[model samples]
Target: MNSTVTMIVRLLLAIILLVFGANKFFNFIPMEAPPEGSFMDALIKTGYMMPLIAVSEIIPGFLLLINKWKGLALVWLAPISINIVLFHIAFDISTIAPAALVFTLNTFLIYINWKKFRTLF
Candidate 1:
């Protein structure tokens, strides 16, 4: 893709990540309580792990926005995507669509930045 298109995609992804991450930290978006006995409920039950997850999301979101650490951001973001996908899948497929989309986007980003990723190996 052209630099312009790449830049736009990157910006869009960064904005989405940052917003979602901040929501995790601040609950800026109202979230319905997960159903009892749900996977999300299990996640919530993990003391302190929630904030760490929030930080993981927020940190990479900020880094992606800066655009200088695209590779590093993707490295951080990949597992996040995986976790999200798994969480959603384990919980309910419908609830996981967003995570799937984000995962797909991350996969594309990784593919697009393959050169940078390859150099690290």
Candidate 2:
């Protein structure tokens, strides 16, 4: 990938993750109500689940923003991104754009950093 494109994508994804991750903790961003009795509703009801995910997103997001351990950050983000897309797809297709963005950005980052992860395979 072109260095400029990679940098742009990285920054875009980092900002997205950091903002949303922080929102999970701070309520700085208002969210729409989850569908009744949906998986998202269950996660919110569990109390810890949302914060847990916040930390999960925040850490890797911070790492990505700082350009540190980017490969590891991308790896950590993969599952979260996948679940985000999956949940949006299953419960709320209308809200799928952000989730898809997260998944696509993580995938692109991983593709660019494949050499770092090749040893794991």
Candidate 3:
């Protein structure tokens, strides 16, 4: 992708990560409770899981926003994005759009930066 498109995607992903990540801690954006006995409910019940996820998101978000260690940031976000998509697909299909966006953006970033990551193989 061109630099402008890459930057836009990075910024969009960063904003999304920051907002949703902060929400996990502050609950500033109201959301419906997860369904009973669902995987989401189980995750919330763990107490630490949500905060951990918040940190995972926020750190990479800042990295992406600042255009620092972006390859690493995208790598760090990959699994979280996958889990987000999988969770939505399995538990709550109605809210899958954001998850899909995250996954797509992360995947695209990773693809464009594949050269930086090739040495790891």
Candidate 4:
């Protein structure tokens, strides 16, 4: 990838993650509640799960912003992105657009970092 493009994408994704993840804790970005009986509603009802999930988002978002251990940060965010995609697909179709964006960014990052990952497989 072009270095400039890489940096732009990295910064955009990092900013997005940082804002959303921080919102999870701060509730600064008001969002509608997930539908009743939906998976998200159930998860939210659990009390403990949301905080952990929020932390997971914050950590990777911070790492990505710093451009440190970005590959590892993307690796950490992978499952979270997948879950976001799946959850939106299954429960809230209206939200899949952002989830798709998240998935795509993570995928693109991983592709560009293929050299770093080649030995893992």
Task: Quantify all predictions' global Cα lDDT against the true fold.
Answer: 0.82, 0.93, 0.95, 0.87
- TM-scores of the candidates are 0.88, 0.94, 0.94, 0.93
Cα displacement (Å) at residue 31, model 1: 1.5
Runs in model 3 deviating more than 4 A are: none
Q: Give the lDDT of residue 57 in candidate 2.
A: 93
Clash totals for all candidate models: 0, 0, 0, 0
As for candidate 4, its clashing pairs are: none
> How high is the lDDT of residue 7 in model 2?
95
Clashing pairs in 3: none
Query: Which stretches of model 1 miss by more than 4 angstroms?
Result: 119-121
lDDT of 3 at 73: 96
Q: Judged by lDDT against the true structure, how good is candidate 4?
A: 0.87
Q: How close to the true structure is residue 15 of candidate 2, measured as C-alpha lDDT?
A: 95
lDDT of 4 by residue, 61-98 (tens): 88988999998999999999999999888877886988
lDDT of 1 by residue, 81-111 (tens): 9989997777667878778877887888888
Residue runs of model 2 more than 4 Å from their true location after superposition = none
